[model samples]
Target chain A: MIDKINKISDVEWELKEGFMPNMSVPARIYISELLAQTLEEGAATQLANVATLPGILKYSLAMPDVHWGYGFPIGGVAGFDADTGIISPGGVGFDINCGVRLITTPVKASSNEMPKIKRLITELFHTVPTGVGTHAEKKLNEKELDDIMNEGAGWMVNNGYGNPHDLIRCEDNGCMKGADTAFVSKKAIARGIPQCGTLGSGNHFLEVQKTAEIMDEEAAAKFGVEKDNLCIMIHCGSRGLGHQVCTDHLKEIEAATKKYGINIPDNQLACAPIKSDEGKAYFGAMAACANYAWANRQMITHMVREVFCKIYGTEYDELKLVYDVCHNVAKFEEYEIDGRRKKVCVHRKGATRSFGPNSPDLPGDLVSVGQPVLIPGSMGTPSYLLKGTAAAMEKTFGSTCHGSGRVFSRTKAKEGMSGQEIKEDLEKRGIFVKATSNKVIAEEAPDAYKSSSEVVRVVHDAGISLKVARFEPLGVIKG
Target chain B: MSFEELDHTADYLFRCRGRSPEELFSESARAMFSIMFENNDANNVGNNGTDNGTDSGSNNCSNNGSNADSDAVRVKKEIEVESDSLSNLLIDFLSELLFVAEVDCLVLSGVKPKITGNSLKAEVFGEPFVPEKHGGGTEIKGISRSGVEIEEISEDDGIYYQAEIIFDV
Candidate 1:
């Protein structure tokens, strides 16, 4: 399989159609040689398999951080033609709208302010509930849950979580269009009500960081990022509610795959045509889940804000939302394909939306610049902040990498390391760490993941997204 | 130990051996809970009166000072997970447990499940978990389809049923 892939450039490769018998188009991957060194065999084959799906356009593309997943490889980006394409739950992933956001602060805490950094992280950890099976005591009734499903971040803002500025900074204004709770399952709704405003376990975290390096001065200035200033990065998703939504929809799509006479290589790739009832219903439910996730992050942001106020003696607006971006979602948008404008369903599973400068859907305040592309690193590493570029729109449907891909298995990590030891090691380096279990700390050890700097550099050098700034964690909290 | 840990780059998996179908199902549940409950003392220690965090200490981690025991409370819930195949049956069973844990903060202890008509019905016993008491561990999100299996394993003594499940965290 490795021999079958043809290198097109220093950072691009094409997998020919013969790589998969049913491929409608050849697959493409954008990765540097350093990253390609660690790309697993299954990840590349999965990328090729995705090209075999009906209605895949131009190519089945993956970013540098690609890794093997259930069906589609993580960091996958593919657009299906609206009139003839299909929607698959695997493409959107089980955790709908699992995403990340950044908050800039008037907090001028440098790397030297270890105590203050520790205090802020500790306060935020308590403010936002985390870990597996973790839920909030401030429960919302069914009515409020439904409202959040339908309203997204607006529900939080209306309920006084934040002002209107918070909504504008989020993708889709934190409210996905065409979202309706009617199609969302009752089970999904029940799970969502309690899980909202939580930081669920496994790779999800809230880190207190300071801007360590700025690569693009103009873009950094536009993004309100000042050198050595403190910032908060929250990485989580819609929680159990979104998980149920995907679980429920997968069954529907699986049956629809058989009824619609669609042939698939893997059951996980079960899908329905965009015009079919199953497809529309799944879209509605997925949009609602996306909306729910936006609201989830907004509520967490509100809690983190309170913690900030307490720690820095500042007000809510003093900690402004930089932007929120969803890495797992299917969006309905109009893109110019082959010189003709057409509607399409762009599935970004484990990939971030890199909306270019002046794109139609960008928030008005950000149109002149571009959407903020947040690429969070694994624990104890630097996360990158970048801007969407026109080159991305031309080559990869305005998509970019999401995070530092994994390397070591959880079992290997546990066998090789200990959470207490890792915690003490990080503390020795001036990083405060808090976690529910030492096991989690061990599993998420910085050694367990690929170097995030290597992953982010691939996209920045390829021009899919331009690097704006890089920040290193000062304190960390995780579930 | 009835179960052994398997390696996966992203998530963790457990392989279990049981003497029969009933044992296989029960052992699988036990193996999963083993991961969910990492602290044996926390599970066995009865109401230490140590004033640890309550069943819902998500917001009170700092106040608890250390990873102290939680305010434990007794509770019971009926759970049922159905599927066409025994492999899916095991996956569904674990998934249902995970769902309850997230929604109700329940830390399930025991299950005596009976299989009937492609479904398993069980009386799940546990307490509403407090991070302070339960010793917060890795939270599983869903069961993965990548490597789930159920089969018969033959030994020198006799034949036994076995199951393997990979959970996505």
Candidate 2:
């Protein structure tokens, strides 16, 4: 059922509407021929389904790392009319605002520091709560949670979890407005109360890496990444809070579908008109989840810095945040659709916003370059630090691929290998690994995902985004 | 029919041969829901309570024997689903069933799902159950379209139907 695609370029393909009924737009895939052939027929079929969604502007787009996912494909990018489109929980995914943040340190990656690197990772794993249902040692009262919902990472900085300057580099300054905590359910709030600083599980990790290469010297310098400098990247999201929020809103939107007479090809794509009560509620709740996620990662930054202090005997001033970017989020931003600037709610699931040079939203220091786009690779792979490009804004709605998207299923990875085997392999390669469960380790083996280098290559070569620096892993921690 | 664990997650899949697509979908839903509760007996409740807070109503059907009805009495209603891909179609189908179950407390009795190109058409049956009165079965947690599959291959027994699904704790 997947043989109908016609190649458009070395890294692009088109799944004609004849491949699926009711498809409003042709599905466009950005992938190598090898990866495209390996793709499950289901992925293409799903992309076609996404095309049928109401208010889907342009083509239903998929990145090179495209994979099958609920509602929209994991690497899918689509925009709906802010006034007429509908929002689906599956589009933003259960891991609301799941993203990556990079922090550069003066420490260099070296053999002499290998042991300390392992110790740092160990300390991080010990300090950060992980796995399913794992909660943090600290709890947030109702007032505090509300404040966090409103302030996001800024609240964490106010509480001394991170430096104030850190927000300058974070997307949306780590806080999205119109986050109504009242829209967030009590169950979600309860789940988030003690999970603000936890890492959670399933492809989430904290890695200590070194800047291995600089693709754009000027851009790299602006982002504060230097060759051989040690950097820390944390990947996580709102955890159970986000999941519950999606669940709560999915039902609400499902009901709204009936009320608004919105016909969705898939129930997972259940949505309400953007101006409806359901849409407003979901937008507010989703923003709240985004804030919760930012605050969650911000708290994790505190834990990472604390662990670093214990391992290097240095102070927090020694390590600095490069930037934080959320991949799974929907935002209302003004962009030119044809020739006119339209305010659209851009839903980027498994995609990151890449606003190019002179973007007013970017910090002044980075205005001449672009927003720092943190694209993390799979464990043991090279993660890239890219800068947004003008082409991104003009072509792909100011977005780029998120990471080395999963190629193989976790079961497939675990069936042929063991976590212990993966750990040993990484250790032999000079990369230290620590995790709460071996099962998780196996599931997240680098082999389970596409090479981030290749994903970055597509974006860079496509001129949608510009590469800055590459970070090679030295040590890692996974939940 | 084949069944495999979906990756390392708590999701599972069961592929079964059926005479029709709706039958395949029915078995798939049953197999997926079986993960949440013990489906071995019609009158046994191990530890999880049988009362699932919400009303089971007259339209609800449990997997147990008390709610069992003859195939003749099982009414088949046409079902159609639209999605971006086969995997999502399966997920949306299951999610729709879950939503119906939650709102109406009806357990789908049988499903004969047919995939004609990208559009899915199925015949689903809804029946009522008295779990507490029947002294069997537990409340369903939640349903998810996790590991889903649709294959055209037919076994000697019948047509093959399979997919993976998750149930909330």
Candidate 3:
């Protein structure tokens, strides 16, 4: 599979349409020669498989962090013609709208704050529910769950969990339209209610970081990030609710795939035409799961703020939300394709939108600047904050890599360092860690993933997104 | 009759084999539970102090003493899933088990599955998760149907069933 991919540029590779049978278009991958060494043949095959999906426009794309996932590669992106395209749950993933949100603090990082960092992480661990089978302090009733499914993060704001301004900072204004409670299942609701404010396990975390370097000072200023200042990054999703929704819908979509006779290389890619009843029902339910995820993050942000205020005498308003971007989701957006502006249903799995400057989807204050693309690193590694670039619009449908994709499996990562050993190593490096289990720490060791610095660089060089600032972890709380 | 781990880039992949389809399905459940929890064989640990006790430093089940109840309360849940194919039946059955584990907060073991054509019926047994004892391992977010192969192999000794399953963690 790797042999078939022809290098198009220093940061771009292409697998022509003929590389695989029935491929509607070529597969485009953004990766540097250095990063390409780690690329797996299975991931390349999956990208080719995505190209064979119906109504795929131009090319099936893979970001620098691409890896083999269920149906779509983890860092894969594909857009289908809205009128004739298909809607797939596998494309969106089980953890619908699993995303990242960054919050900037006015205070700067200092060596004296080590004790304070420890206290903050401890408080966060106790206040925010984490790990497997952990539930929130407050259980949502049926009516409340319905509202959350419809309103997204805005529901949290309405309930006094967050400020109204936070809504504007999120993609789609913290909510996706067409979300109906009628479409969501009781199993999903039951799974969601108890896990509303939770930070579920497996690669989900809340990190306290300090901006280490400012690459584009102007962009960094616009994003409310300053050199040496502390910030909080939250990574989570809709939890059990989203998982159940995808599980429930996949069965229906699988039946629909057979009914529609849509040929797919992988059963996980089972889909239905966008206009079909099964498709519409999935969109409604998916949007509701996306809303639930946004609400989950908003609630987490509120709790983080309370911890900050309790420790530093800071006000709730002091910590500002930089931006929130979904990593796993599908949304309708218009893009100029083949010189014709067309609406397409873009499915981004383990990827984020990199809408360039002047894109209408951005908030008013950010119109002059591009969208803030948050790229979180693996445990104990540096993360980058990048701004979307105009070149992304013409090439990759304004999408970019989400994070440092995994290079080692969970079992593989455990071979070297035990979670306790990794924790001690991080503490020695001035990065404090708190987690529900040592298993998570060991499994999420930095060695398990690719370098975030390298992943962001390939995209930046490819003009998908440009670096604004870099952050180093001061402390982390993992589920 | 046993399951072994396989390496994948981002998730958990394992292969299990048994003397029959029922054993194969049961072994798959055990394999999945083994991935989700660090100490799945809780009965081996003799102490009952695992019920959310003050032992915060370690998640090991105490094996020194065996109390009358062993502090671990066992519960049972039954599920029936029907599909057109045996593969779908396995996916549906495992998906149901995953849902019950998360929503009901049970770490299941001792699965007894009965299969008739494309339908599956199973009774699952486990204790409610005690974070103090059964250390939560990596969470298995979703069960993937990709590369799922259930096969029956004929050997001189007898016929055996085997399957390869991938999980999204």
- Candidate achieving the largest TM-score: 3
| Residues forming the 10-long window of minimal summed lDDT in candidate 1 chain A | A130-139
Which segments of model 3 are wrong by more than 4 Å?
A: B45-70
Query: What is the DockQ (computed on Cα atoms) for candidate 1?
Result: 0.42
Task: Place model 2 in a CAPRI quality band.
Answer: incorrect
In angstroms, what RMSD does candidate 1 have relative to the true structure? 3.0
Ranking by DockQ: 1, 3, 2
Writing each residue's lDDT as its tens digit, candidate 1 over B92-113 gives 7877877775566666777778
Give the top-scoring candidate (DockQ). Answer: 1
Q: Judged by DockQ relative to the true structure, which candidate is superior, 1 or 2?
A: 1
Worst window of 10 by summed lDDT in candidate 3 chain B:
B52-61
Q: How many pairs in model 2 have backbone atoms within 3 A of each other, for residues 3 or more apart or on separate chains, i.e. clashes?
A: 20
- Candidate 2 Cα misplacement greater than 4 A, ranges: A1-3, B1-169
The lDDT ranking, best first, is: 3, 1, 2
| Residues A119-236, model 3: lDDT tens digits | 9988888888877767887789999999999999999999999998899889998999889678789888888988888888889999999999999988888888899999999999
Give a tens-digit lDDT track for model 3, residues B46-144.
344344211122111222243324567777889888987888788888888998888787778678888999998888888777666676666777889
Between prediction 2 and prediction 3, the one with superior lDDT is 3
**Where is the poorest 10-residue window by lDDT in model 2 chain B?**
B52-61
lDDT of 1 by residue, A374-429 (tens): 99999999998999998888888889999998887888888876888898899998
